[model samples]
Target: MAETEKSGNAFVETIKTIVYALLIAGVFRTIFFQPFWIPSGSMKETLLIGDFLFVNKVAYGYSYASCPSLRLQRFGIDVDAKDICGFFDGDNTRLFGGEPERGDVVVFRHPVSGRDYIKRLVGLPGDRVQMKAGVLNLNGRPVEVEDAGTFEEVMEPQGPQRIRPRCANGAVGDGGMCIKERQIETLPNDVQHTILNIGPQRVDDTGVYTVPEGHYFFIGDNRDNSLDSRVPAAANGVGFVPYENLIGRADRIMFSSAGRSMLFFWTWRGDRFFKAVQ
Candidate 1:
């Protein structure tokens, strides 16, 4: 009886410890930073698939989108951020809000689908944004863009989604080289980042988009592949995201793996560990 009691006591203590640890982690994620995993190639060379980073939630202050949305499909758990903090949404306000600067890489909730998307914030409230012949035009001025050779990667399934990359050099077989034209684009704020282009896309030339007040426009680094503000939300694209939907800024990549699973130690990219997001 005594041995059984000791074992039960140990089990109870272990459970208590786990509960406390989980609570602390939850609070940390909610208040300070949120872990974001790059699951797509939209950001391409800048933020590749399987890159893991912690978003600085305090950068833009707290909003409904700041709350973590836990969705474990296998476990049948689907807790949306709106479900946790829906009361704080729809006001277009944030507590201790700070304006996001143009050219900053941000993670925001989609205005219509409520899905999280990471992109470079290119248009602020009331800014006129347009893409003219594969170039970014801001307020009637074309942003400076310089050809920077090419970006190459193996043509194979990427991440867990098994999504293959589009190549400027046409379709290539598995393990073949996939190439995309690379360019260094300089924003009005003087922030420079590398952007990839596969070819001329439908969104390459678009009419001017006037960003609405309390909303922002964003675009992906992979110009041709991104379905960002260039397309309307009703058309399955991420339209102008509201200010309240701003989650945080991704400042650095904590870890990166080139394999399907992070547990595959052999696939880790050592150079990207703790790398700052440019």
Candidate 2:
């Protein structure tokens, strides 16, 4: 019996240690650093397929951190509205912290698919956004595009067979999908970086998407390659992102590797360090 009692005590202590460690990690991930992986090429050139990044959790606003832990009043009655359970069990939002700024790289829930997407917020609420001849435009003004020099071969397209190939989801592409490679483009600053561009095969295009209030319109830096707010998602594209759907902000690339090759820490990137987000 004594042996069993000692074993029980050990198990309980182990559980407590684990719980404490998890709590600490969660706190760090929430207030300081959160890790995310690049899933799609939508934000290519800025972020790549295998690139792993860290987001600033406090950059946007508090998620669950904003909630009051306990009622402050001594003799207060419980309010039903404050106690109402939401769609997802624990996640709840009372109010927002900060609004996303122009040129800020952000991660938000997709309006159509309800998935997370990292995009550069080009247009904001009450902004007249227009895309013409590969140039972005604000209210009667061009959104400024500069000619940054060149970058190394970064993103690799699927392959020649993918051209006109039924998209991964079997969405038919305009025969001869597109041939793309590395090229240079002017970033927000005069700093140049290699961006992806497709030749003569834009599958989607639209006109004058007026960003509604409490929402934002986003597009990929790879203009011709991305199926962003321009194309219809019912077919396959991001529409408009509401303010409430925001997750957090993509602040910096913590690390980069050639493949899943994370074993060799030396092989990790040293150049693409703390770059001010685009």
Candidate 3:
């Protein structure tokens, strides 16, 4: 009986050690290096639904890069609560880094409902941003378009049948197919990036907006199909994120999976591993 008790105790101790190690690893991952899984088509060609991305939480600043431009002094500290839901304590954590550059990919808390989203920076404070004929214009420069190619998007089937959009015989932007091949280049500051255009019409193109100080103007690369700053703050979209909502920067794409669901790991798209974010 004595020998059996010793063996049981040994097994328990071994299990305890393993559990503790795993718990610590989880803490490190969630705090510093979190693995973000793409769940929607908002980031289309750049990031697929099953693509798992690793975000560098320390790139911009602390957990919440709430500080103003790395140009201005950081916000300093949290003195009051914000939002009715109490989502975040509004702790104005500051940092001494440079402001987010034009082409940097950022993650921030949505202003309307406090949800988190990933998007590319398009306009800085005091800059004019507009989307006309499906092309994003900064200040006065028209973003150039390039045909990168097509992608198979798996989305919810459209609603009931209705009068289809009239098709004119010409290039897409000129008026042709519904969701055809289209691309454009947006020059934010001096950095340029590829933007996919599905069509020439979008409801988000309300009008020109001048990004206010202490806030940033953002939009998704998949212009034709993303809910972003274009929507008013009253509509539940991010309405010019304040420095307090800045999360971090997407430094790289760790891995991506194609058609297959995230459940099947053995069939992951091995070719996408270690691809740098452009």
Candidate 4:
């Protein structure tokens, strides 16, 4: 009888230890950093579809979305506390130092849909932004851009259907099809980043957009394919992202896989392992 009691106590102790460990891990993830997997080619070349990255939660300080109290509603736990944790100009935790700068690749919550979106900061507060024939123009001046080369990636099958190497950039003939033209872009802050100029998409030409106060403009490295600030939120684009919606900056690629899902370990991209997100 004593032996049975001892064994039961030991099992209870083991379960308690696991529960404590999980609670600690959850707290850490909610406060300092968060892991995100890229599921789309919106930020391709810079961030591939299968890339896994850690967002620096302390980079821009904490916000309402970063607070655990805000997430309680989902678990049937209600907290009447106001949403005022993460703010730059207002009172905030100020855990770290840094603000979003032009050319910085960041991850933020979509203003309308509340979905997480990643893109490069292109327009700062009060900056005039526009695009002319696929070339980016800021503050009445055209941004500098130079041709890099071509980029090609396989479009894997969806479910049981197979995909062919169709023209991705809307190019004619067999030569210009199935590949995207790369270009090196220099932002106003002198931050250089790569952009994919695939085809003459609708956003290739747009009217002047004067960024309002406390808002920033973002665009994708894949110019023609991304639905970013150039498009309105009502139209399914991110629209002008508010400062409070900012989450964190993407620092590096933790891991990468080319498979449709992570279960396909055979499709792991070994070369992109631990690659710095430039």
Query: Residue 175: error of model 4 in Å?
Result: 15
lDDT of 4: 0.77
Provide the TM-score for each candidate, comma-separated: 0.97, 0.71, 0.72, 0.83
Candidate 2 vs. true structure, TM-score:
0.71
Expressed as tens digits, the lDDT of each residue in 1-278 for candidate 4 is 99999999999999999999988976786677878888666787798777899888777876655643333455886532134443332432234535788888898878766667899999998999999999999999999999888887644441112223334555344434368888999987888888886678889999999998878899999887788999989988888987767778898899887766777889888999998887
TM-score of candidate 1 relative to the true fold:
0.97
Give the number of the best model, judged by TM-score: 1
Which of the predicted structures, 2 or 3, would earn the higher lDDT when compared with the native? Answer: 3
Clashes of 4: 2
Ranking of candidates on lDDT, top first: 1, 4, 3, 2
Candidate 4 residue runs with Cα over 4 Å from true position: 68-97, 158-177
Per-residue lDDT over 1-278 for candidate 2, one digit per residue giving the tens place of the 0 to 100 score: 99999999999999999999988976676566667766666676788655677776566675433221223256684432123322322333425468777766777656655556777777788877776666666776664455553333322233212222112222333433333444554434343444555443453334777877777878777766676766656667877766656667887787665444466566566676665555
After superposition on all CA atoms, what RMSD does each candidate show versus the true structure? Answer: 1.2, 9.4, 8.9, 4.7
- Each model's C-alpha lDDT? 0.94, 0.59, 0.63, 0.77
Error of 4 at 97 (Å): 6.4
What candidate 3 gets wrong by more than 4 Å, as runs, is 1-19, 64-88, 91-98, 147-179, 265-267
How many Å off is the CA of 10 in candidate 3?
Answer: 3.8
